[model samples]
Every structure is written in structure tokens, then in C-alpha cells.
Target: MNKYKLYSSTDFLNDDSFVEWLLKSDHDAEMFWDTFVEEHPEKKNEIEEAVEIYNHFKFTSEDLTLEEVFAIWNNVKHKSVEKRFSFLTVLKYAAVFVLVFTTGALSYYLYNNATEETEFTIAENKPLNFNEAQIILSDGKSVPLNSKESEIKYDATGEQVIIDNDTIRQAKKEAEPTINRVVIPYGKSSQVTLSDGTQVWLNAGSQLVYPSVFKERQREVLLIGEAYFNVAHNAKVPFVVRTEHADIEVLGTSFDVLAYPDDKMFQTILVTGSVSIETKSKGLLSGKNKMVLEPNQMFYLDKESGVNYVNNVDVATYTSWKEGMFDCDKLDLSRVVRRLERYYNKQIHIKDPLIGTYKISGKLDLKGDISEVLDVIQSFVPIDWGKQQNGDYFIVKPY
Candidate 1:
């Protein structure tokens, strides 16, 4: 049996001060509480009681005198003795008893204070920072669709490319023009709505080099990182996404590509429609090596061996981020932290290596508060997190 620590009334009072520190400081106090509860289950009841008192104090401006505070403490002590519950009593009962009394006092205060104005101000809105990729023309000039710009018509091609409100728009033209190579920097993502109205969502630290317009023969795009594509159907013009090791050709489909340069494998998950992937380096373009995928199928290419494998998976798990949710299906801690880093734009350091291997499966709404999301994750994982000097989080596997 694990030896549990018992928190006395004094300890409960000290915890009130800790709650104040938790709210004022930038650290993730809820994560701390989660780990603390796991380690000291015996004190969980006392800690919850302290939390109720702290919250009650926070909502009221009337400060209790030291004498009044002592009196209240004595009242609580007397009730504990009168109840004469066993020391091994369940934590939930104690928490409920403490909360009931605290809530009674809070209700009385709120009812008597008629002049106290309680207005809720909406929290400050933080706009989503989208990463964008740009196409740098062959000339010294660059076409930056992610930046604000006025519409300009190309004198040579007569094709209209509008850069406004930090978005790039390409108007359909009679003739498709050739485009030069472009690079996408890290921490940025850009979208290209194809001539057929297909949308592509690019991930951060990735690049796609393509022409200004596609030719009649074939529409080809070079991918370096991760991107999601809703390909336009044109039997005459096949849509081909080319990476370093393999090429994915599709007639009309929606799929996600994960081919980060540093990663060991390139993954292509088909959400809808069908796609054929071919490997040029392995000289395995033969029917035996070529892999075809249907909806809900994922194809992975090993970087070292140039071998491809296909598996069935849940399509929503890969596409959830586009819909403003974090969906993880048995994902390891490292992968979870990686997605969090991108979403929050913060660096994370895991103090314990073993923690990275812990698998997690859940879907968290990105539209909610970050702390709420963190609290939900803490409920499932055995770890503690706190803010670092640079406003990032330091995650540690608790003993």
C-alpha cells in the first residue's frame, strides 16, 4: 500500500495561498494539481476543501478578520469531530461536505450584497495565426500571396493573381502559364485553390513548388512537408503530388500527405476517392510493388528501404486539425506534444524520456481555452507541467 500524506487544517490554509499563487502566476496550476492529486490521494479531500474556500474568497470583496477566519476554522473542526468519520473515509464525501458549507456562505453573501456589480467581460480574442507558403518567381521579384497587396495583372501573361487581405487568389484564364520554383519557410503555410476549385491545406515547416498554372498534359506539384489536398477531377489532367521518394497520382480525391524531411517515413492518407503511389528510386513501379488506396486507407513509405505499406485508419484522426480539433488515436506523447507545439507556437521540453512513449487517444476542441484542453489531457496522463522562463511549458513525468 502506498503511504499517503494527510493534510491538516493548517495545510489546507496554506493551500489557499498556493491557489492564489496558481491563479496569478503564468504556470499551469491545474496540471500541478492533477499530479499532486495522483501522488497524494489521501490529501485529495483536504485540498478540495481548501480549493472551495479559496474560490469563495475570490468571488467576494469582504475580507474576513483573523478572528472570523479562526472561528470558521473551529466550526469546520467541530463538525469533523461531530461526524466522527473514520480516518480512512473516502475523499469525495469530505470534499462534498466542505463544498456544501462553503456554497451556503457564498449564497448568503451574494443574496445580501445588492450593490455589488458582477459583470462578466468577454475574454480577449486571440486571432488564429495561419502559416502561409509563397512562390518566389524566377526573377528577382517574388509573388507573396500571404502578405497584403493590391491586385496586379501580369503584363506578359494577362493572368490575374490577386494578393489581398493576406490571401492569394488566382483567376481562371484561357491559357495556363508556366510558373517558376518557390520555397515555403518554416512556421508558415499557404493554400492554393486550383483552377478547378480544389483546396489544399499545407502544414508548417513544409514547401510545395508548383507552376503558376497547370498544363494540359498533367498537373504536377512537388511536396516537401505535409499537405492536405482536395484534388479537382479532370481525367485529361491527372493530379500528381511528387515527393522525394514516391509520387501520388490521383484523378479526383481528398488526401493528406505527411512527408517531413527529417521524418523516417512518408505517409499518405486517403480520405475519399482513390490514388496510386509509385516509387521511382526502388525501381519497384511494377504491379507487385505499386500500392493503390481507397478511402480510409493510409500508405507509408520507408525512407531507408523505399518500401511502401498500406493500412486502414480513421480518416477523421488525420483531418481533425483542419476542423479546429486535436484528434489523437493512440498517439505517443511525442507526437501529441509536437501537435501542441504547432498549435500554441511554443517549445516543449520533456524531462523524462519514458513519458514520450506514453500513448494517448482523445479529441480536444481547439476553439476552447488552452487551459481547459490541458486539464483534460492531464486527466489521462501521469505528468506535471508548469510554465518555463520563456512562457513555454516544462513537462515532467512525476514519480
Candidate 2:
């Protein structure tokens, strides 16, 4: 018999009837059984029991002879049963085996295969961690704040208080303009009180450019990534937030803007007060393309189509980050990853394309470590996470 035949035949050793038939057969059959038992000493008892049952089946049933059983065993072992018997005849033999074994061996085999360990490789591309906050003076110089020897200076402009603690001195200007940019790099965030008494929360990997002070007409600030603003009500001066895709203008209201250059859509959500959004042409804001937004309304602009849509949503989900939590409702995996990247300061890659379309709804404690967030998500998906050569953590599908 071929060695492969013996290996395959071992699968049937647990079947009692097959063992009995093999034991009553000729010397060649007995030699095969002995060799199998010698090769698998761990299954010696099971092999002996199977052989006893085969002998019983051959002798107890007068219809079956030793020669007939041996021929059937040889036919099955060589896979030549098709030449000797029709499909119906083979089915009858199979029915006898099923009656004796009850498919116990096959069931166990399938169970083992189903429980086998599968490994998935997740790409390591996590979010960026902006840890340093700095202010760019009107003279094009960057001054790092949060330093130890910084003195806090107080500058009062109307009702707004400017804390110029040496590390960040407010650029003093009187109307003749210059563009002063405040950069919040990776791994850092900063809070700025604009000249209009509006409070601005700048997230990591973002930059805000504004004049030294607000002019007489409008309060304007250019944003790169994401920010939440609580505008001071000055009915006369409309506060304008400028991003690559759209411009948001409000009289005095609280709102959030998500305008990452890599994002496919620019979103603005109003919590309190009213605002107007203007989509830029060729990525530049100008003219009559402005759309107004009321309280509790969100303005969404498709980055590619240049089309704007308005909808109502639970505002808390958008503003939860400021409160140290991430609350999402039915958001896609890609959108969730984007938020994670901004919060953790690392890049993330989803190796499994199917994961991108997976929709999730949950609240995460933003104050917790990034790994905790990943673990929470892993509960629903089969993901493998690891670091890359560039030191970013990426998530991928498991095999």
C-alpha cells in the first residue's frame, strides 16, 4: 500500500466496523494494520478495538465473507471502488460506515480545522502626537510656549484678555496688516483667545494664521486641520474661519470645523449661534458661493464635487473631543481612523479593505491611551496591529 494510503487510512481507525473488517482479511491486511499500530503507538487501544469490531462484523454477518471484506477494503484504499461498484453500491458501503461511526471522526477533523489559529498582519500607521505649541510673531519668528522660564503678560483689548507670558507674546499691531501664523505641531495642542474674545481650541498637526489683531470689519483666521471655536458675539464683526475647502463666517456663535487637507469632506457643526459657509472655487474662497447655517445645523461640503449639503445631527458627538471623549454614531471605519490619527498623533493603514467600510458606533475615552482605543475596536473586527519602520502603528486584516 502507498504510504499516503496508510496516512489517510489512519483517519478511519476510530471507526470500529472498518477495523473489524481489516483484521479478518488476509496476511497483507494484518501487516498493514500492525504497521499502522507500530507507527501510531498512541492509538494502539483504538486500533485494537477497531480490529475486534471488524472481525465481529465479518463473522457475525453470514452475508459477509473474509474474502469479500478484504476486496472491499482494497478497493476503498486504492480509490478503485468506482471500477468494481456503481455509485449506488459505494453509497451502501458508505451507509454502513456512517451507521457504525456516526461521522465522529469526520466531525472531529472538521472541528480541529475550524479552531486552528489564524494570524493577521495589521499595518502600523497610527496618528501623530503634536506635543509642542508655539506662536509666530508678525516678524516671522517662532516662539515656543510651555517653557519653564516664561513670564505671563496681560494684554487687555476691550473685554478680551490676552496672556502674553513671554513664551507667547501677542503681536501688537495697529491696523496696517501682516499675516502672523501660530503653528501647533505634531504631539501638541494649544488654546488661543482671539482678539475678538472668541476662544479657539487648536488640535494637533494644525496651524492657525491670523492678523496681530482683528481689524474693524471681520475677524478672520485660516485653519489647516481641525479646531473648535466659541466666538464672542460682536454683531458687527463676522468671525470667519478659512480652510482649504470652504470658508465659515458667523456673527458670534460656537462651532467646530474639520478641514484636514487629506479629508474628502469639509464639515462645520454649529452648537450655539449661527454661521455661513462658502465653498471655494478651485480651492479658493471668493464671491457669492456662501451658504448660511442656522443653530443646530451642520454644513457639509464635498471636497471633490464642490457641492454643499446641510443636515441636522446630534451636536454633542462632534464636540465630545473637547470634553475628553470621542462619541461617534454609525460612523464608517475610515472616518473613525481619521479621528484616531489626529488624537494619537500617528498614521494608520487599514490593510483589510473590508475594514474601511465597517461602520461602528461607540464612545471612546479620549483621555485613555491609544492602545486602549485600538483594543476596543478589535472586539468587533479581526485585526492585527504593529509598528512600521517609520514608527507608525497600522491595522490590517488577519489570516
Candidate 3:
């Protein structure tokens, strides 16, 4: 149940969970509304009013594949504005639908209009510090993965960590299994095939920690940075990805998790299947701390403040880094420079903060030199830069 006590039609309809239940018959929605009505009969009239508005909109989600949903959304995109509510109706509100029973199955609804063919653009973000990938084994051996296509695989018996025939480390089954870690620094990334056939692409400056083998009922891993997961489905066993801000309960899905420790926001984008992101909080006025995400939806969490938001976005933009390419749609110059700074391990100072808000879009291959990459960005936007005597680069809006 939403803790704020939704009393308006816009509040109820804006909630993805309410829409899911109304359109898809979600069980949690079924249970939640029933209990909410019983507890607060006074607000019964407002709940019904919200339902009436939802019926007027006539959105449907029965057996529609993700592609079809987007197609329908695109077809109606122009029409939504023509209608009475307009897209303004979907603007920011706390759905807050997850309670103890419902939180387990909660999924958030995103607010993105970009399709797969659509480019992604993010601006004003900072960079990382890295140059290569390293595998830190349980036995204290450090193996360098210098190749672009570096692959690491662990055996099911918790026996070996293999990069080709080279065994980075080995542990006896009789001994206590020590967890291993993979470190991928900026300017480089690596892929790992877990024993269960699950594939993960660790993005630049990301770290993944997991046991050498599966743990009976659960397959859990910790991420200090970003990664793309194609979780091998085992209905009896659930795969969970843990980060500093939230716990992503994998529901047999392919998704991307961006949770860098230095970054303030934690993001998860679902490409296929379903997943629930759960956050915990205490206080009388706090809403149920859960939001389940659907495919093509991205959930964003503000780490320091514990605020949550969801948006519909293209899956390719975030996942394309795994393909050795980076796509920015309309991202601001500040964020683009940050990414470049990490990739090149250099300093880029933007003297005018307003200049960083300028938007640009392009696709750049990671194989290019940092200067060449910066040159590409420069061609599209009105900006100038020069290097100082001490080697730091200063970016400024021309006089």
C-alpha cells in the first residue's frame, strides 16, 4: 500500500503497479487494493475515482510482447498529447505500491520514449580511474586480462578459475571455498561465463564478486560498478545482484546494472523478463520500499537520499558499451567529458558550468585515441579547449 495515501486520480493512474494490476491482473495489486480499501474506507471514493480515470485511458497489457508494447506506445504517443490527460499525467509521483507481501513481486514502470534504434545521451557525468582488467584469485594470484575479448569461467565444483588452460587458482572441495573477484578498470572491460552458463559483461571500472560455484538455493553476486547480466534461468534457484544501494532480484532476465561506488545514482535497465529492486527504510511515513521493473524500463535510485524513480528508456544505449561502442543521445558536455577523462586517464576542466549543459549526440568506438574522441565531440558542439603547461586540459566557451 502506498504510505502517502493517494487521494487523486492522477496519483493512482501514474503508478505503474496500479496500471499493471488493472491491465495485467498482477496478484500483488490484487491483494494490495483489497487490503487498502479495508483499512481506509474513507478514501474509497478517491480510489474509485482513480479507477474511473484509468478505464477512460484504456491502456492494455494482456500478452503484449515488449516490442508490441512500445509499438502501441509509439502509436499512441502522439495521441496521448491530443487527449485530455497528456503526458503530464505520468509525471513524478510515488507509486509506493509494495508492502511486505507485495514487495517480493514488485516491479517499477519506467518513463522512457526512446526505442532500441534510438540513441542514448547523458550529460554532466564524471569519469573513472582504470586502464585494464585484473582477476584477483582466492589464493592471492593476480592475472592480467589484456585482450579486448578476455573471458573468465569458473567450474561448478568450485575447483578452477580458467582463462584458457591457464589456471589462475585452484581450491580443494574439502576446503572452505574462498570468493574470487574480477576487476575491470576504465578503458577496458571483460566477460565472464559463470559455471551455470550465465554470461556477464563487466563494464569499464566495474568489479564483480562471486563464489567459485553455485550456492544451493541462491546464486548471489556483489557489484561495485556496472555490468550486463544474461542470467541462466533456474526456476528453483534465484539469481540476486547486490549493490550498495539496492538488491536486484533476478527474475530470469537479461538486464544492465550500473552501480558505481563513486556515482550517486544506481540504475538497472531490464531488456527481457522481469526483476524487482528492493530498498529498505524505516519511519512511520515511509512508503513500501519496493518497485518492480518491466522490460525496457529503468529504475534509478538516489543513493545518498534514498529517493527512487523509474523511466522508460532504450536498452541499447546502456548495453552498447559491451560491444566496444559508446552511444550518447543528447547528453550534456560535462558528462561526456567525464567519460572521456576516465577512458584516457586525464584531467579535463570545464571553467564555465553553463557550457557543460550543451547537448550532443554521436557514436564513438573505444579503439580511438582520447584526443580523437574529444575531437569528434568538439565537431558537434560549440566548445574550445587547450592544454596547460602542467598537462591539465582546460575547456572553455570561446570569448
Candidate 4:
């Protein structure tokens, strides 16, 4: 199947067809599994190990209540035909167990196992590049923001004010809500506070279009690129973030959204509270569907395939960019470089494409010079860089 390949052990373990075959001996699933087994017999060991992992973390082991366990088992019994039960079938049921529970919301959650020893293909292209940060105030006056420290703050009375030291930035005449747009260019970041007390850390190359004050029942904002938001809780008012790829609705949550338009994917990582994400992609059975995310879970939507997958991740790894640090655990070199390109507003071409497959662990501070970061990277990996006449960088295997 063009749609099928090994994303990770977690992918297959949480696959629908695989789970169907496990629980119900579904006809199509049986065919796929039979063909898969015939083709890649070597992965049988891995498949078995994934099954063991599922069983170990079953509802009984997790925080699921006894009623949940009993309800799921009842469904399992109905799914299983009157035919004799096999040990393999039982294993399948356990391996794909996470799919059984779905939130009542119109969203879907695809979970992953984090323990796979797999090298994933990473996107390296960066096309949403820009040069400067700006604030478009209500009077149509554009105030330039510096890369060092650019910030904005507004209040419920619809007042706008810039927060860079030694700067005179103010807005007057606010009897109603007014839209304010803040654009943060690549190589820089910013911070903003909405009138509702919601705080947002705008990442490099991001644009946030928000209202100067909250109105009525909802607080909505439009985002491009990436941002981390700690929404102020108001039970009567909901906070929503709209991206090109998805719409995230929340009551109150701390979450990070990475929706760089040029990248091959859109990603969201939930740090705390809950969120319901609605994709513009129309659904088959539901007409339109949404995907709900729990804390510490990350979702990546492949732009080309329109297929999104979720996995467990260290929340800090994705959210740390706002803190001027890049935290990764065995992340692909190409992906790391892509992020650096955005943060530095520089282009880096890897002379040896194979080096992109290399993975690095740990964290690096992004507040330093680009050359300094490269030096640290080279110290860890056998790589070096040369600057081109055009000011772009070329990374190569050191002499």
C-alpha cells in the first residue's frame, strides 16, 4: 500500500487494520497482514515486541477505571467471532488497544510508542523566510521591531503599547476592540499579551493577528508560523487559535503550535490542559472531523499525504524554542538544521545529503551566533561549514 510503510513500531502497533485483524480477524486486514508477513518476515520479531508493549500498558495497567476495562472487553468479545480464539489474536487486540477509546469530541487522536529504533525521513526545506518584525497598529502606523527584544502589550480597553526599553510606543482612543497584528521575522522572536491576560510567545518567522480586547463569548486569534500560548482561564470564554492547517479550541491550556507554511507538516504539542483540533480536511464517515490532544502528546500532519499522526514526546523538546534553546532527543540533523535556518534567517545547504540522516541528542542554546552554533554542532558531529559569496552557508564533511 502506498499509504503503508514503517513509520515506527508505534505506527504499526496503533494501525487500524492491524488492530482490526487482532480483534475481529477482519478480511482486509488478514490479507494485508498475510502479505506483510510474506514480504518482511524479519520484522516479525519487532511486531511481537510491540504486542508485548501493548499488553504491559493495557487498561488495567493505565489509569483507566474498572468500568472502562470491562466495557472495552465486552466490545472485544463482540468483535471476536464465534471461532476459536488464538494466542496471536489476543496479542493483536492488546497491541492496538489504544484505538478503542475515543473522546466524544469530533476529533481523533493517533498515539505512538516512543521506543522505536527507527530513522525517520525529515523535511529540510525552508520556504517561509522573511527579514523583519513589525507591529501594525490601529492607526495603520507600522512600528519596526528589533530582533533583540520585540514585545507588545494591550489591555481590555483596546490600547496598544510597545515594550522595548528606551522606546516610546503607545496607542490612544480605545472605546472598543481593535485588531492588532504583530509579525516576527525569521531569526527573531517576540512576546505579546492580549487584553484577556493570555500570554503568547511568538517564535521566529511568526505572525499573530489578535484583537486588542476580548469580546463576548470567545477569544480568537490567527497564527502563522509557530507560537506557544498560555491562555488565561475564563470558564465563560473559550480561546481558539486558527492556523492554515487546523483550528485549535480550548478552554484554558498551555500548548505550542508549529505551522510553518513551507514545511511538509503542521505540528502541535500540548503541554497542559486539553484541546480539540479541527482539520480543514473533510472526513469520509463524519463529513468533517477533529482530533483531540492530551498533555505531552504531539501531532504531525503530513502536508502531502494529508495524513496526521500523533505520538508521545517530551513536551519540552518542542516548546523549548521560545526559551532560546533547541532541545532534541535523537532528532534528525536535517530537521535540526531546518529549525536553525528559521531562527538565524540564513540558508544552509548540506553538501552531503546523507548527513541529513544523522541524529543528535541533547540541547543547544540558540541565543549565540550562527557560527557558534555550527561550531558546537561540528564538535558533536563530523561536519563543518563554509560561507558562500552570497552569504548563505554550505555545510560539508570536515577535511
Candidate 5:
């Protein structure tokens, strides 16, 4: 059924799926809307008005933030209401607004974007100092989680944070959503339920920055390591996961993103629905600046060469870490070792680079000790491993 049969032009404009249809970003959205218009012929007028309103504005991140665009939009809407004019009628008088806001905002963005980006870059380079998992609130308060796999949930209002058995209330002094961060150290993982009810499984050695509540315009989160997101459905406000290399946008979907700053590659595996990835082109080998992925597909970006590509993949292999299991499907030995290092909080040095290139596949219970997991891997491959004097494990080719 067409869920948006009763949506007004304004509602359609706010809908992420509708915008996706308009932008032709997802084939599923295009198909669904085509069927919707066919079934609800009477909605043609509303749809046309929405299309017109949407097409009239050409705002990008380079020009203005979503808040600024919304402010200008509200001004136009107010004029329409005061004059008792149609949406299009008010747009006729919005030329000056469009020009002035666009030009001024673009100039301001150009002036400050570099500094803003530099600040974040500097922060990203800093080392993680916390020994345990913790949640840092906007009020500069830090709530520590001692559990190895802690569960942190927020109420829809974003003011109440439920960490395990305790509920902590935050003061909401302003209309804007308060920013919060979840930091997970090595050998620890956490699950976070955002204010919007989106479930995020934060893996070991990860950090997630999100609002206590989502804004009307969008729901966005910044991820420093890896996380699996089961985004809540909010057609009116798209959910976006921002990483160092790419911005992934989805109306509602389940996906796993691996973008550890130190890792050589960035990856996104879609479990269901659709997502669009806009890669930040920092180097020459970036294949495409923008792409859309379907379910069961993976988007991979090689940071070293600035190359990215999409391919079909078994979603389970990438997302299983969240489920207390590590499913390896013919993956490289070095890649598997890196994940183990994070999971177990122990350094495993591959003494022979040739041993790291060997492909191995298996499902190992991550709950067991690191040695037990390594024994399982050794059973499947010809490798010898032992602990070093420095208390780290070393893998070598068997004599």
C-alpha cells in the first residue's frame, strides 16, 4: 500500500523517500512512487506541488546547512500563510531571499569550512585515552560503563539516558538536540539506542557521536570506528551516518559500516533496504564520488589508493561481530587478525607476511578466550602461534 496517500505537499517535501524518488537515487523508491501515483490518481495535484517546491530549492552542504535552509523555508512559508497565497505564489516573491541567503551563506561556508574541517581532523588524530567504555553528554559530563558489552538507550525525548540499570536525566535548556558521544575501548562493545529508536551496535574500539534527539531536518551521527545501524523509519527526516571517507544516507535500513581511521579501507555492507554513499574524494584513485547500494551489496573504499568499488557480499560475514560471533568467509588472515586484535585487546603480530595472505573462513564464538579462538583458526589453517615476551601473540609459518 502507498503509505503516503494522505501526505500534503509540505509533508512530501519533508519525506526522504519522496526526495529519493525525485532525485532518482534509489530504484526501489522510483518503483514504489510510480505505483503509488498510479493507484492514487487524485494525489497528482499534491505530488505536482511537492515536486515543484522541491525543485525550486537547490541547496547543498557547500551552500548552506540544513538549519539555514529550513530557516529560509520557514520564512517563505510564513509569507505564504500571511498573504493567504499558494506555495507557488509565495515562491514568486522569494527570489531575493534565495539569492541573498545563497550568496551570503556560500561565502560564509567557504570561509569557515576549512577551519571546521581542520578542527575535526585534529580531534580524530588524537588517541583514545579512556580505559573503559563511556558516554559523554553535551554538558561535559561523562558516564562510564564498566560492562564489557553495555547497553545504552535513550528515550524519545533524548533527555533520559538509560545505561543498563540506571536512568540518567539530562537538562534540555534549548530547542536544539543535545549532542552525546559513546566511546568503546578495545575488548569492549556497546549497543546504543538513539532518541529516535534507531538501534546501533557499536563494535569494539569505536566511538559514536549523535544527538540526544534528532532535529526536524535530519538525523545524523558520526562514527569513528565500526558500527551496525538498524535505523528507525522516519520518512520525513532521513538518517545519515557520517564517516571520514563517506556520508551514508538512508530513509530506514540496516547496514554495517567499518571506517576505523587507522584501517586501510572503509566498508559499508547493506543488509536491507537502500543507501546512498557520497565519498569524499581526497585522492586521485577514488572511482566515483557518489553511489547507491542495494541490499546484500558492499561499498568498499581503499584509503591508501583513494579507490572505491561496490560488490555483492554476504552481509553476515561483516555484521556478525555484533552478535557475539565472528563469521569469516574466506577473508584474509591479516584482516581477520586485525579484528581479533580489537576484539581481544591483544596484539597479534604476523611474523611472516606470507602467512597473513592466506585465506581462511569459519565461524568462531567470540565469547571464548583469544587463545581458544586462535586454536580454532589454527585447526583450519597451517599456522603456529605463541605468546611473545611482550605478552603479545605472534603467528608464524610452521616448519
Candidate 6:
């Protein structure tokens, strides 16, 4: 007997087999659904609607509560063209529920009871622990690069990837555009040239998710941690960088974005050209919540206190990391050490709280060893460091 013969969109959403097929986890489930869809063409609309919801929500039956189910049903009922319907109407109208699902674009959907906009989380389930930098292809294949600093270049067609000396050819399907991801763990960095000629320098402990080829309408990429972008000039198709808190839009601009998930503040520094930062509370197309930044201007947002402001500053203070150096303009010692920890993949603790408040100024050549870098920092501040038994370093008052 075909159990899914009379199944509605809601029933399919509640079924585990359907979810497995949607996630492409079970081959048998995929075959079953394919054959069932062919045999039961009447349910094609229902399955399409359910797939849209599943892709946008990424929720399973357990994630949805009874009240939430009722809400979905009520939403469908209210939007249905037929004012009157039976109890078994199903959730076919959910496809028209004003959800956002663009191919190869950063997701901006509703969540936490489907009330507000939910940003795309970079590494919600997976931890960043790869020793080597890697590129995760759309087909779930991971290509690892074993260099301290890797260079990646995508051809104009986005069908070929050149990683250092090796070249990889990837087949593209027009129906399903590919979205590639680059993950640079601690102690490593990567420079990627997108298909559109945009250049991006990804810092350590950072990840960037971008499409293999940009769509005609726009070019957008999702960023976590820090990156410096020299975007290509394409006024017809604006380039956008999306972080957890804000989306930076620019036609062709050079900027630095520091948006580490663990960091309390999200910052954007415009080195050249102009860009607009839009928070999640406001729509991207709307100008009400957009903060425009001119060259040499910076936009800062404190994720914890919900406070944000703009300041004019030297662009080198924020962008020198990509040039194999760190430029400090009276930056805090604690902030400097944090970057060192990520760049060296080592743990360092400040035993005294007051030491963290010490301001440091100057430039640091990051190509040297951690000990050498610490020595340079020591020259700027009165601090001494000792190694613990576990290989971790601790900062204390000078002996």
C-alpha cells in the first residue's frame, strides 16, 4: 500500500522518510520519493510546496511544536483563495507564505517561531578544527590545501578551480547552481579570486560561502570571521557581503569586515569606494536601516549592547593583516593577543585584568614566530609571558 498517496504537505513534512529524501541522506528514500512522485502526479504541487518550506526552515518534525503546526495551518487557510475549506486542506498554500529562498544566495528567512528574520549561521553544527585550509564543493566533496597560506582562483565560467599549482575542473549544472565554501582554520589564511574577478583575503578562523558563478541580478557572499574584499566593478549587479548582524552592499568597493561569531563587536572599514551596512531588523532593499560608509570611514556594531556608531580612521589599522602584518593604532593588548591566538593556533591568558586594558601601538610582522611577535609586543608594553605545562602561555607583570 502507498502510504504517501493521500499525504498532504503537512503530512510529508512530519514524515522522516521525506526529510531524508530532502536532505539527500538516504538513497532508498530518494528512489522511493522519485517513483512515488511519478506515479502520483496529483501530489506534485504538494511535494514542491513542502520542499520549499523544508529548504528554507531546515526543521524536522521534532523542531515544530503543536502550536506551530496550528500556526502554519492558520497561515495557509488565511491566504488560500478559497475562503472556505475542509479540515483536510493540508499546507499547500505554504509556498506563498512570503519566504525567501534564492539559489546560491545567503538565506534570510523566519525562525524561532517564524516571527523574525533569521541570518545564515556559518558553523552552527560543525566545529572549525581542520588543520589545513579546505574548499567544500556543492556536491559535499572537500578539497584540502596543505599550505600555511593558500591561493584559490575560480575561472570566469566558475567551472574550474585553481588551488596553488593544482587545477580542478568541476561540472556545472544550470538547473542547480553550485555554492562553494572556503574554510580557513586557525594558523592559516586563504586568498580567493571569485569568478567575477572580485578578490577576497580570508583571515584565519574564517569561512566564506559564495556561489560558483554569480547570478545576473546580484553577487552576494556569506562571511564569518574576518575578510578583506576588493570587489569587482559591476554597477548593474551590486556585490553584497552578509554576516550574522549586517549585510554590506557595494557596487565596487574595497573594505574590511571583522565579524567573528565569538567577538562582541562587528566592524566594517571602508578603504576605498562606498558601501552600505544593513542590519537584520531592516529589509535589504529598504534604505531606512542602511548605514552608508564613505572611504576611510568605519561602521561598528556592538552585538551585545545593541549599540553601533561610525568613526573616521586610518584604513591600514584594519587592513594590514592581509599584508602579512598587524597595524595597531593604540589598540588594546587583549585585542592584539586574541588575533595572535587565532593566527598561531595557540592559547594565551592574561592573568591580570588590568593587563588586558593596556594600549598597544605600532606594526607587527605576522610572518615571524609567535615568540618573536610576543617580543615585539613586549617592546611596546610592560608585559612578561611564561609558558604553562600544557604549552599555553600566560601574561603577568614584568619580573
lDDT of 2 at 142: 49
* Candidate with better TM-score, 2 vs 3: 3
User: Candidate 3: deviation at residue 287, Å?
Assistant: 6.9
Using lDDT as the measure, name the better of candidate 3 and candidate 5.
5
Q: What do the candidate models score in CA lDDT, each in turn? A: 0.61, 0.63, 0.69, 0.72, 0.79, 0.79
lDDT by residue for model 1 (275-390), tens: 99876533322222467899999998876655678899998998776666778999998888876765555677788889899899989786565566667777889988778888
Please provide, for model 3 over 40-73, each residue's C-alpha lDDT reduced to its tens digit, 9 standing for 90 to 100. 8887887888888777863433233322433344
Provide the RMSD of all predictions against the true structure, rounded to 1 decimal: 28.3, 31.6, 17.6, 18.9, 16.2, 19.1
Clash number for each model: 5, 29, 17, 4, 0, 0
The stretch of ten residues in a row with the least summed lDDT in candidate 5 is 104-113
Clashing pairs in 6: none
List TM-score per model, in order: 0.57, 0.60, 0.64, 0.65, 0.68, 0.68
Q: Write the per-residue lDDT of candidate 2 for residues 1-399, one digit (tens) a residue.
A: 243244333456655544544534557767766786777776676555554554464322122322243334533544442366454564577655433222111000001112442111111122112355665455444456563112222233422223444334544445435445556765556677766567787776777766555667647777888888998899887787867667788888899998876677889999988888877554122223778777778888876656778999988888887766889888888888888887777888887778888887878886777888888888866677777899787888876
Worst 10 residues of 6 by lDDT: 100-109
After superposing all C-alphas onto the true structure, candidate 4 shows an RMSD in angstroms of 18.9
Better of 2 and 3 by lDDT: 3
Off by over 4 Å in 3: 1-132, 282-288, 389-391
Candidate 1, position 27, lDDT: 57
Q: In model 2, which runs have C-alpha deviations exceeding 4 angstroms? A: 1-132, 146-154, 158-175, 283-287, 380-382
What clash pairs does model 4 have?
106-290, 107-290, 107-291, 108-291
